[model samples]
Target: MKVSAEIAGFMKRLGHEFAQPELLVRALTHSSVVSPTRPDNQRLEFLGDRVLGLVMAEALFAADAKASEGQLAPRFNALVRGETCAAVARQIDLGQVLKLGRSEMMSGGRRKEAVLADAMEAVLAAVYLDAGYAKAQAVVLKLWGARLDGVAEDARDAKTALQEWAQANGMPPPVYDETDRSGPDHAPIFHVTVRLADGRSAEARGQGARRSIEQAAAQSLLAQLEALA
Candidate 1:
């Protein structure tokens, strides 16, 4: 099948040439643009999620033969989370080739973390279907290169760490409040504040998802507390 220049460029960036080019096209199509004849990437996303999880789990297990399951779980979560997937998508400029609907495009769907992450997973499924598990594993490892090495540090949940710090200092757990929200419904920005019993507080603003924003706020508060120590 003939592929467009844009898709060709994207293939170069992705480091995988699709044998079934239509798979890649479907992978790039979002739910907003779905029809009876033209399907979306949701099914691909589901399958790709499992493929990604298996790859990461196997890689993590092999990388650290001595680490406990507890130690590895958070690391796996850190590597496969939407935020991390979005980061990988951004690295490959995946958003540039996405086929979004008019409404989604108007709402900045290309830049949205959730959209990018889901599309990234679908692309992985496409690659898997086009080639096989070996090619898909190689692509994932290459794209997630340094992240695998730094998974240990990244696995530390800032909110949990902050709460532990507060408990150790004889203070109550910190409180997180959603101070404000703005932007369109499809892509809203969240402002969150985290405060401890001792009045130490920090605020942060983030886009895409509120939970991620809350985590960012917690991380900010933790940083401030650590700096004063």
Candidate 2:
């Protein structure tokens, strides 16, 4: 009951409210929220994933009318990915509004990338179901439109984007060296340091090799750029 008010307030910021409020409730419920007959947002998450993809594709295409498919695909992938969505989801404070079982809630499940990202998809699907495709598109665009504004070949990945920006501006591409790795090989936490050619550096962590390198590169490049400015 009270969940409705919270969600309504959230959707207002998100620029759309649900016509059928139950869909929004289910969207905010992780799989941990279960009952004798009803399930959680898993199915809606599945549907929402497709909806998000479709909407993102449309956004990518419309925004980049001149980009080749090969070029557009990766940029599209990066923009709509789990990490990006989870980042955006976290920005919206979705975790605060999510409904989860006590065990999951206590274990930081709401902030988990998979949960946050999937919940975003579920919310997208809920919007779609409530008001159909166009309104859903409007909601998604409002959230991600600025990101789509100037996509290009150089804009493939943010990590890549930062690297290219550095290189073009007479800075060396940041170097990502593994500082340490922990946990099992199958799921290791990598500590990577990003060193600039100009004797500056920074570090960041990521769950896997490519991500670690990218994040480290981003941190170093961002720091250098900020300092220069």
Which candidate wins on lDDT?
Answer: 1
Model 1 score (lDDT): 0.91
Give Cα-based local distance difference scores for all models: 0.91, 0.78
Question: Over all chains combined, what TM-score does candidate 1 have?
Answer: 0.90
How many pairs collide in each candidate, listed in order?
Answer: 0, 0
Please provide TM-scores, in order, for all candidate models, with all chains considered together. Answer: 0.90, 0.72
Alpha carbon lDDT at 59, candidate 1: 95
Which tens-of-lDDT digit does each residue in 64-183 have in candidate 2?
Answer: 689888888887887788877887787778887888999888777766777888998899899999999999889888887766675556446657767777688798776777888886
lDDT of 1 by residue, 1-229 (tens): 9999999999998999998999999999999999898899999999899889999999999999888888898899899999999999999999999999998998899998899999999999999999999999999999997999877644868888888899999999999998999988777889999999989899989777787888888998888887888
Cα miss at 47, model 2 (Å)?
1.0
